[model samples]
Target: MNSQDETQIAVLRNLYAKQAHLIDTGQHEGWAQTFTADGEFHSPTYGEPAIGHDQLADISRRFSESAQQAGERHRHVIENIWVTECDGSSAQVRAYVMIVGTDIERKQARILRIVTNIDQLEKSADGWLIRHRKVEY
Candidate 1:
């Protein structure tokens, strides 16, 4: 791979890590900003795909609230990330996600789900943003 590819890959890796941190910390708005303005997220567990940043933020907020209400914690382990394709301005990425859920009261944590995330990313003025993300369990 060329240096440019290496740099892009690094940036993509950082993006994934940042995304996980945002979600884990319940930074819903910050997490939503990782997406493009018109980005879409498809999750089987979420009932329907969330389209656009507003919808995405709403979903994030709902999830955060639900977890908080239940006294639960979520940690998303993103691993095995592969940049399947990359151009100067866009890339296709796939990664495995393992969500660990913790019960604050019981101080117990367990793997809640495992899935593969396929993301379509684009380079915008703000840097790389997710154009679409489809989650497969």
Candidate 2:
């Protein structure tokens, strides 16, 4: 691809990394901010799609609490990110994510789930943000 395409891919990859880190570290607000104000997240695992910032943050908070209570630490590993479509102002991307969990006391890490993420992204003044995302097994 062209240099511009490479740069865009790098930026998108960085965004994914930031999102992963924010949620893993229990930065609920920061993780929700990775999406647009009206962003939507749909996943079978969540039962219902979280719409808007409040719901997004709530989901993240719940996830954090559940992990904490279980004495486990979770990490999201994003891989095989592909810019399936891009037109400067918007893009469609796909990625594979592996959710790894570690037992805090035992210090044992294991893969919990592997999911595919299909995302619709928009470029805004602030940068590229996820407009909608669908996660599936």
Candidate 3:
């Protein structure tokens, strides 16, 4: 890989890290900003795909609120991330996600779900933004 390619991969990896931290800390709005304006998040866990930043924010907020109400702590562990393909303007990436959750009553955290994320990212004026993210079991 060329230096530019490596840099792009690094950026995408950082993006994943930022996304995990933002969602884990209940920063839904900030997390939403990681996507493009018309970005989409598709997850079987969510029932339907969340389209656009507005919908993404709503879904994220719902998840955050639900977790808060249940006194649940969630940690999104992203690993085995790889950039499968990259053009100058776009890339395809994949990663494994393991969600660990702990209830307030229980001090121990346990694995809740494991899935793989397939993502399409595009280079935007601001920076690289996620155009579509599909989560699969």
Candidate 4:
């Protein structure tokens, strides 16, 4: 791989790592900022309909509220990410994510879901942004 290729992969990895941290910490506001204004967030499905960034924000809000109400703690693990077509400014990516939730009251660990995402990323004047994201369960 060339230097340019290395740079692009590094950028994408950094951005994605930040997103994972934000989600794990329940920082919905910061997580929403990681995408472009018109970015879409979907499930891990290969062809699921997506809600826009604004809608995603709303969903995050509701999720946070519910988590607080239930006193739940969660850790989202993103693994086995493979990057293709790296071009310094954009690329296509695939990743597998597992969300584990723990209920303090019940003392039980549950595997909430498994997710896969195919994402298109672009780097603009501002920074690396997710141009299009398709998620499948």
Who is ahead in TM-score, 2 or 3? 2
For residues 6-124, what per-residue lDDT tens digits would candidate 4 score against the true structure?
Answer: 77777787888888788667788777777777878765431344455766566556556666676787766788778877776777898888877789799888887888878988778
CA deviation > 4 Å runs, candidate 1: none
Better of 1 and 3 by lDDT: 1
Cα deviation of 49 in candidate 2 (Å)? 0.6
Model 2 per-residue lDDT tens digits across residues 49-131: 99999999998998898789879998899999999988888999999999888999999998989999999999999999999
List, residue by residue over 1-137, the lDDT tens digit for candidate 3: 89989898898899999999998887888899899999999999888899988889887887787777878888899999989999979989999999888887878788889999999999988888899999999
TM-score of 3: 0.94
Question: How high is the lDDT of residue 62 in model 1?
Answer: 79
Alpha carbon lDDT of each predicted model: 0.92, 0.94, 0.90, 0.74
Better of 1 and 2 by TM-score: 2
**TM-score of each predicted structure versus truth:** 0.95, 0.97, 0.94, 0.82
What TM-score does structure 4 among the candidates reach? 0.82
lDDT of 2: 0.94
Model 1 lDDT per residue over 15-99, tens place:
9999999978878889999999999999997979999888998878877777788789988899999999999799999999998
Poorest lDDT segment (10 consecutive residues) of candidate 2: 62-71
Q: Estimate the TM-score for candidate 2.
A: 0.97
